[model samples]
Target: MGIEIEVVYALPDEQVVIPVNVEPAATIQDAIRLSGILERFPEIVLEDRMVGIFGRCMALDHPVQAHDRVEIYRPLHASPADARRMRAEARRRRRAGK
Candidate 1:
């Protein structure tokens, strides 16, 4: 049987609640599409993009359970590993009084 679930979108200034009729085995991406988020936020490009569910990184096609919170992640401009390396280098220099 189809189920009704609440899909929430955390926008810049507001929250959008969409009640969706979904099969119990739908992925988070499917839920977002059903929620019309891609239609609402045209800037969200999903190809090769990372996604998270309930604050944990997950595969794009990861299955979403009922009441699951899905969050689409935008690509970072810089690599986090590189940023950390830079910070560590700066700290080393400061310690050496250079």
Candidate 2:
């Protein structure tokens, strides 16, 4: 069988996953370009973003395997530390019945 892969991109309220079929040993970049994700989302800049396969960081040159899931990550609006602190504070307030 031929190689089957998925390219996924998400926003705060929506997500798109595209299934793509290719010849044996397609690279991640090839899959992303073929998926038409960039055309759909004009805001995505390939040079400004990071992409991964199954949540693991991958290079554009990396060869894809069968059933590989490619993910395009959006830039975070807030820092992880700040987000965690906010969540913790909210939890504390809830526990105090605020």
User: Best candidate per lDDT, number?
Assistant: 2
- lDDT to native, each model: 0.74, 0.90
Best by TM-score: 2
Task: Give the CA lDDT, 0 to 100, for residue 76 in model 1.
Answer: 70
Global CA lDDT computed for model 2? 0.90
What would the per-residue lDDT of candidate 1 be over residues 6-95, giving only the tens digit for each residue? Answer: 556565577766777778888877877887878887887766656777778887678887767777666676699998999999999999
Task: Give the lDDT of residue 68 in candidate 2.
Answer: 94
Native-to-model Cα distance after best TM-score fit, residue 27 in candidate 1, in Å: 0.9
The alpha-carbon lDDT assigned to residue 26 of candidate 1 equals 85
Query: Candidate 1: deviation at residue 65, Å?
Result: 0.7
Off by over 4 Å in 1: 3-19, 78-98
